[model samples]
Target: MSYKVIVNATLAKFSASHFLKEPFQCSRLHGHNYYISVEVEASLDENYIVVDFIELKEKIKIIAQSLDHRVLIPELSSDLAISETSESIEVVTNTNKRYVFPKIDVILLPLPATTSELLAKFVHDKIKEIYPNKRITIKLEETKNTIAVYKSN
Candidate 1:
């Protein structure tokens, strides 16, 4: 039989800034208090356990802390022209909108965009690395009513 465990969004959250490529309002830089919830499914171990709650929460905490209070930049976006200096990173969209941010305040993700769907996959992959044999699901909430989900089988 298989068992499942979850780390709810309420207990695992982070604040970060990001922008999307389309959807006019989202194209402008903004920040959100993002929440991430994780669900892991796997057969119980010999000890009749799926996973330790504390351990899973700690791992999620680490990933959240890394993204907290940072500007997420998509390094793989063809729609963006990015440049960096010792102190700052500059970005310009294909539409010619420009932005400059401090290097220390940014996180360059290897993604085409920082949309919630991609971010959910990003988080799913991170957790998958830690639990290679288990099924993982990540629910990423960008706002109160908007959420994106990613699953790894």
Candidate 2:
């Protein structure tokens, strides 16, 4: 039988968030260098190889670059009725502070929470968008040990 191997890649989710919901309001308005890893299970065509590491690395880079250095706000989600303008993007937050992405390269992901679980699903969906038919597994980690994994069939 033939076997295949998968790989992992990660990027920092640079954004500020208030950790707790009420009272303490912990999060500290900080950012996380979110790490994202992807695994692709592919049996080599007839050559007994999984896939090209170079090609995979490039693809992963493209996705991470989109989110490398921008202020991530849940208000920037896809589900929100939001719009971007030349001057700035308007976001209504409980803190009532002005948070904006300084550059156009910054990407705002549509997720309910900045937690690991949401991040995993977010990356999985993003990869699926790039490669529609490939069965892939995704792992999103906030730090070295903390992580969330995802798979698509």
Candidate 3:
């Protein structure tokens, strides 16, 4: 039998997007209370039927600590209109206006836009870095009613 674990991490963020050929990748600037759920396939330890929630929380925390609250900039983000400085992030829109974000904050660079599907995959990758040879699944929820999952091969 396999055991599963779920961990909660407090998260906040900001971003923008617009579809192809449009201009921006997202509709407009937006943020969400992002939650990450990681599922590991392993037998329970000698004392329990699954890994301890605290241990799992620590594992998940390593990744979450870097992204808890800040701007999420997709490397695929359009326009190449971003500047990183010691104080703030300067985001210049396609139209030439700029938005600044405080530094010493979280800024995640995802390969894809901050959609649930892609975010799950991104989280899966981070988890893999911790367990190089083990299989795992990552689930991300933008809202309680919605979620996306990525299962490793």
Task: Give every collision pair in model 2.
Answer: 9-36, 10-36, 12-34, 13-34, 19-27
Per-residue C-alpha lDDT of model 3 across residues 1-153, encoded as one tens digit per residue = 666665543432212222222355453665676677777766666797455566666767766656666666665667547777778777665566566767655374755456678878887887778766556788777777888989888
Q: Model 1, 32: alpha-carbon shift in Å?
A: 0.9
lDDT of 2 by residue, 36-148 (tens): 67776655665556656677667677766666666555544433343577856555444544444443633556665455676677778877786565667877766668778
Residue 129 error, candidate 2, Å: 3.5
Report the Cα lDDT for candidate 1: 0.93
TM-score of 2: 0.70
TM-score for each predicted model, relative to the true structure: 0.96, 0.70, 0.70
Report the number of clashing residue pairs per model: 0, 5, 5
- The TM-score that candidate 3 achieves is 0.70
TM-score ranking, best first:
1, 3, 2
Q: State the displacement of the C-alpha of residue 82, model 2, in Å, after optimal TM-score superposition.
A: 5.1
Q: Highest lDDT: which candidate? A: 1
List the candidate numbers ranked by lDDT, top first: 1, 3, 2
Name the runs in model 3 displaced over 4 angstroms. 1-26, 43-53, 94-97
